[model samples]
Target: MDAAPLAARVTRIATLVAGLPALPPDDGSRYSPRRLTVSWLLEAESVHTEIAHARDLGAFLDWCNRERLDPLTARPTDLAQFKVWRGAGTGGTPAAASTVARALASISSWYTHLVANTDGGVTRNPVAAVKRPPVNRHTSTTAGLTLDEVDALLAAADAQAGARAAAAGRTPTGQARYLAALRDRALLRLLADLGLRISEALDRDLGDLSNNAGHRTLRFVGKGGVHRERPLTPHSLQALDEYLAARAAAAGTTADRLSGPIFATTGAGGDGRLAEPNIFMTLRRLARIAGIASADRLSPHSLRHAFATGAREAGIALEDVQDAMGHADPRTTRRYDRDRHNLDRDPAFVLGARRASRRSGNQR
Candidate 1:
C-alpha cells in the first residue's frame, strides 16, 4: 500500500506500452505478445542504438496502425519519409548506412516470421522496396613491418631488453630482471614464431600450451572459430621454457596446471592473480620500447603480418602460410604478400633508372 512501489509498477507498465507494435485488424489480436517480443529482439539485434531506435520504430508502427495503414499497402514514399525522419531528429543522430541496412533486415525478419505463423498471409515484405545507401570501397593499402624491419624489431627487442634480462641471474641485482626478460622474450617469440593475433596470443590459458616429446606445441582457436595447431619453433620453445620456469618461481605455483592464464604478471598482489595482459596496453608498451615507426599503426597485428610476410619472402608457400596463420580463406593470406611481391617487380623502379649514355643510338 506504498505510493513508491505503486509508482514503480506504473512506470514499468508505461515502458512496455511504449515498446508495443501497432494494432492489427482485431484490436486485441493485432498486437500479439509473441510478435512484440520477437520484434523487440529483432530490432535490438539490428541497431547499435537498440532501445531508443526500437522505441521509435514501435511508435511509428503504432501510428500506422491507428491510421489503419496496411503495411502491405504502404508505398515507397511512406518508407522514404521514415528514412528522412530517422536521419533528421526524434531521438538520436542519423543512423549509419550499415545501421539502416540492418534495421531493414530486422523488419524483413519480422515480416517473414508473421508470414509463416499468422493467418494474415504477407504478400511482399516492405523493407525490400527501400534502397540502401551506397558504400565506397576502401582502396588504401594495408601497411605492415617489412622483412628487414621485422628482423630489426626482433633484434632490437632482443638486444635492448631481452638479452640484458637473460643475464640477470649472473648477479644479485638481476633476479627480477631475469624474470621480466624471460616473459618479454616469450611474448616476442610467440608473436614472431607463430604469427599469432594479439587477441589469440593473450586468449591462451595454461592448458593451451602443451609439451610433446619435449617440444612445446600450442593448440588454440583462431578467427571465424577455427581450431589450429602450431609447433613452437626451437627459439620460441626455449623462451617458453624459461618463461614458465620464471613464472613458477615467482608465483610458487605449478606451471603445468590445467588452469590460469598463460601469460600474466610475475609477482603477486594488487590484482596480479595470474591473469591475461590486455592486448592493447601490451602493444602500446612494445611500440614505445622498440622505437619502431610512429606513423604506422603498429600493434600486435603488425607482428602477425611481419611473420607472414617474412615467411613468404623466405619462399614459404601460400598454403603453408595460410595454415600457420589459421586463415580460413587463402585470399586473406594472399593480401599479406601482395605489396611485397609487387615491389619486387614494380615498373616504376625498372623504368625510372637514369640511362647513362646511349652510346649505340644510331651513332648520334
Candidate 2:
C-alpha cells in the first residue's frame, strides 16, 4: 500500500465515512485497508454520529501531529498522554468528563477498526490500555426547565405568534415574522410535550404526521436510526394546525397541499428545512421572554430533560417514560429524572415497614 501523509489519509477517510465524494487515490489503486475499515464502521451509524466521530478523530489527529507521534503506531503511553492533554484545558476551559470519555471512545473505535482490518500492519489498540474518566450516569448536567417555566415559555411563544399575526397586515416583514413565530410555537410544543430530540423534530415532514388507531401521532427517526412515533398532545396538535394554516396562507395554498418539511425555514428565498442553530436561537429568545433563569443556557435538550423530569414527577411509570424518551436503557431514562434521589419513594422505607409488620405479627 502507498504511504499517504497522515493528514491526507484522515481527510480522505473522513470524507468517505461521511458519505461524501472523495478524490481518487493518487496511484489509481484500491483504497487502503484503514479506509475500507472506516467505510464498514459507517454502515451502522447515522450521518450526525459520523460527523461527530470525524470531529473527535480530527482533534486526536491534530494532537498526534503536534506531538510527532504516528497515530497508527502510537503506544499505550502515548494514548494516555493524549487523554490528559485532551482534558487539560489547553485551548480554553477544561473539557467535561463526558466529553473526554467520548473522545477516547472515538479513538478506540478507530483503532478497533484498523486492528480488525489492517492484517499485521497495525498490531493492537493502544486506547484499550488507557483508562477512561468515570462519567456519572445517574445525573445529567444539561440545563432543565421546571414545569412552571415550561408553561411560561409556551405562553411566550403563543404571545409572540399572536402579536406577529396581528402585525402581518401592517408591515412587509410582518408575514415572515408571523410565519416564523407560528413555526417556533409548534416546534416548542412538540419538544416540551413529546420529549423529541431537536434533530428528530426537524427531520419531520408533513407526511410524517398521521392518524394511528384514533390517535394523532408524529413519526420520527430517532438516534441509531430507530423509527418511532409519538402521539401528539391536544396542545401540540392545535399549535401544529395553526402553524400549517399560517404557512398555507403565506404560500397562497391550502394546508393539505403542503408536502415538505414540517418546520420549514421562513427566511426570504430560503424554503429548506429548519436548522438546529435557528432552533437554538429561538429557544434562547423565548426563554428570555419567559423570564427563565437558565434562558441563556437553554437548548432543545433542556426541554427533553424537562419532559423526563416532569413525567417522573407526575408519577408516570418509569418504563413508559423510557419508551417516550426513546431511551434504549431504563437507566438512561432514570438519569433524566430529576427526582431520582427523592427519599419519599425509597425502597428502603418499604423494606423497613415490611420488617416492622413482621415483628408486630410475631408479638401478636
Residue pairs with backbone overlap in model 2: none
lDDT digits (tens) for residues 267-363 of candidate 1? 5331132223344454545555666674246666677777877888787888999888877778778766645456765666655552323444546
RMSD of each candidate relative to the true structure = 11.6, 6.1
Query: The CA-based lDDT of model 1 is what?
Result: 0.60
Identify the leading candidate in terms of TM-score.
Answer: 2
lDDT of 2 by residue, 1-364 (tens): 1244335545656565444222123332244544654664455344456556776777887788788777778899999998999998566889999989998998788788777776766789999999999999888898878899999999999999988878886775888888899899999999999998888888677889998989999987888778888899999999999899878877888899986779998877435778788888999999998899899988899999999989999989999999998889999998888777888989999999999999999999
What lDDT does the true structure give each of the candidates? 0.60, 0.82
TM-score of each: 0.54, 0.82
TM-score, predicted candidate 1 vs. hidden true structure = 0.54
As for candidate 1, its clashing pairs are: 24-30
- Please give the range of 10 consecutive residues that has the lowest summed lDDT in model 2: 20-29
TM accuracy, model 2: 0.82
